[model samples]
Target chain A: MSTSFLHSFQSEWLKTRRSLAAWLVIIGGFFLPFIMLVGRTVYHEKTSAESTSPLFWENLAGQCWQFMALFLLPMGVILATSLITQIEFRNNAWKQVHTTPQHFYTLFWSKLMVIMVMVVQFFILFNIGIYLAGAVPALLLGTVDYPSQPFPFMYMLKTSGRFMLDILPVVGLQYLISLQFKNFFVPLGVGIAMLMLSLVMVEWKYGYIVPYTYSPYNFFELRGSAMSGSKDVNIHWLALSYFAFFTVLSFVLYISKKEKG
Target chain B: MHTIEAIGLTHHFSKEIPVLENIEMRVREGSIYGFLGPNGAGKTTTLRLMLGLLRKQGGEISIFGKPFEKHRTELLSNIGSLIESPTVYGHLTATENLTVWQKAYRCPKNRIPEALRLVGLHGTGIKKAHQFSLGMKQRLGIAAALLHQPSLLVLDEPTNGLDPGGIIEIREMLRNLNREEGVTILISSHLLPEIEKLATDVGIIHRGKMLFQGSLASLLLRQHQASRIAIETSDNAAALQLLAGNGLDPRIEAGCINLAAAEKPAIADINRKLVQHGLDVYRIATVEDDLETIFMNLTNQ
Candidate 1:
């Protein structure tokens, strides 16, 4: 059983690795954050605000979250999810896989594991891109004094960590959507629409319930602001709860539904 | 020990319409059982039900003497199948396709090359399945089915897209597998001639009903009386008159007269009568009972 599961997992990974969409997601992971960092650097260089306070790092992390939620993370999730399901739909490969002695859970989890691994890899690479984009330029040009305190390493780490944690809800939701929808555009469109709606609600006093709104909220200290007052709402917990709930729900649907080859 | 036994098996896609009705089939341990049918004749549905691909609405299916639904993995482990078209990753090469299934089946590493060679696709390594012709793809499909040295191989339309050479090659390969390894095979095809060549035992299905099921000899014997004798004569008018006068109003074809009879003496009598009548008996021969004829006769009734 273990051998069969491992083999299925290996085959699923090989299929993903060979996909053009997987490569695109990986490339976008590196490219998007680099572009953000470069833009921040050029702006900082022009303004001479190089590392003005811990708020600078918080602001940079906010930018990263916004960029990822808008395109990078959703694209990565779609690519990974579609990579697994499309093969079955296109070639009717599930019939062959199901005919083997391997159990259904083995096949299901193998494909699921591949998607999870890809999402994790995208997250790590995106963070690395952000670190390089900001850190390398700061070192090259040196930190400049500004009106507030300088950006600290602890603040940068915390901000990056927060951004990574906030995106989990989107990843989980996209995973569910991709599994359910055969049309590629549906998930992409739905994700973008939800993100945009959350962005719109961010300005309202009650926008803390909007998942993407809280995604960028924790990165910076609102400082007696209305958004800060809603900190007790804890977007991290909401995100994690949503992630766990939907992941289980999607898994149940997958296991319970009679798979048609 | 039968490789497969489905007793009173029934299934339906919708509640009102049953796709398979009280299907009782037994595939002998090591024989090539041809599952004959027309389109939508429940051949695929029967295979699916036996393999536990679909939930059975009635009755039980056992593979190698164990219930299939209750012990699906164990039963499936010893059986390999190609349900419809070849289910292989087009992006992967032939070797990669085999490797994927090999891993899934957890078969011995040594069997991969042997399976490929058995299907006569041994040397086309690294050629992606998309690059293969329909014939190669079908051969690859068979190789995948045979990868685990399965005891029972169930294939549906295994030779659908093959050229004449490919068809002959697969027929020979299947015969070898049955003979050399003693693997039992349950194959389904609409082509009667192909099944007639490969099947030792036969099951004919029409419109979701099992019309006949038995050894080829038994099936042939059952229709032996329905067998016809054809005779060609220089004068068709005189031959028809001679045959009718003897109460053997033969069925007429373009250049021959056909009479349904089991006894050669009756045909010989008709031939001798024709010759004596100066009808010039050109040819007198017995037409062997083929599956097509039996299929037509069975389904028509």
Candidate 2:
């Protein structure tokens, strides 16, 4: 049984690897953070006064992680979900899968694991690109004369990890939504709508509970600050709860119902 | 042992109407069984239920002496099926599609090329499935199903969109599989002649009911014994009078008399009697029971 499951998982992973959409997500994700780092470096090199600021490294880290949360993470989620589910829906291939020796849970999990792997790889590569891009410019410009704050690798890692953790709930929810609706636009449309609504609620001072609002909360908390004038919100607890809820919900939805081909 | 059996099978899409009502069918091992039905006759539904793709409302399905619902994964492992149109990934190459399904079934790697060769698609290298013709796609579907060397193969309308040559090739392939490999096959088709050529046993369905299920020879013999005699005479009135006078009232249609007869001598006797009655005997022949006639007779009744 384990061998069968592994074979199914490997086959699904191969399919995802060959997909054009997976390439787009990985390339676009790595590009976003790299672009932001380059923009910061050029702006600092062109203006010596801006380079003199002590908090420049912190600001760059802030921008890099924030850009990922806002744009790259959601884009990756949508791409991964659609890539995993669209082929099955378009070709009606689930009938073939259901008739095979592999169990339904095994089939479902193989696709889900492949999507999760894509997202995790994108997260790690994007952060590393951002770090290298930021570090090289600082070293090339001579840190002694520039006198900018030291780049905090640990803080960046911490913040990016938290940001990724916060997005886990939406990842699970988007996966469920993608499986529920075979069309690619519905999950994306719903994510964008919820994102815009969360933006409005964050300003209203009561939106900290929303998953999207946690994006900025994670960034600010990394800099040792709170966004809503309250330090009572436990970032670790919130991230853990979100991950648990979404994972459980996704499992329930997947295993409890009959999946038609 | 029976390769497939469904006892008192029932299915309904909703509470209002039943799609299949108390259906029962059996197919012997190492024989090709043809399921004949018209449009909306619950053929696809029956296949789905037998494959454990749908939940049975009531009844039991057994495959290779195992209950399908309880041992679904194990039973399905030994069965290869192509239920509807081939549900292959269009973006993947023919080889890639086979690889994916091969992994799903966990069959040995060597059987991949062997199955492809069996379907006459051995050398189409790295071409995406979308580029295949309708016939090639159907063959590819068959290749996917046969990859695991299953003991039983279930195909629903396998030759739906094939040309005559493609159809003949598939028919030959199926025959070879059954004869050479000893694989039991259950094929559903509305094409009577195609089924007549391939199937050893046949089951006819109408309006979600099994009208008849038996060997092809028995079905033909049953229909032949209840034979209809068509007699054409110059004086139709005199022939009708003579036929009814012999206690055999014939159905009259356009100067011809059609009536059922028990023996061949009765036909000869009717011809002799009509000739003796001063009527010119034009034609006297027994109508051989074709599938269409049998279908009409069974369904109309």
Interface RMSD of each: 1.7, 1.7
Model 1 agreement with the true structure over A4-46: per-residue lDDT tens digits? 6788787677766456557765786788777876776677654
lDDT of 2 at A149: 64
Clashing pairs in 2: none
Docking class of 2: medium
Off by over 4 Å in 1: A1-4, A37-62, A135-232, B120-127, B230-258, B265-284
Candidate 1's displacement at residue A151, Å, is 12
Worst lDDT run of 10 residues, candidate 2 chain A, spans: A140-149
> Which is the leading candidate under DockQ?
2
Q: Model 1 compared with the native: what TM-score?
A: 0.84
Calculate DockQ per candidate and list them.
0.51, 0.56
What digit string (tens of lDDT, one per residue) describes model 2 on residues A145-207? 343666676766776677777666667666777776767688778777767765676655566
In model 1, the clashing pairs are: A53-A149
Model 1: lDDT to the true structure = 0.75
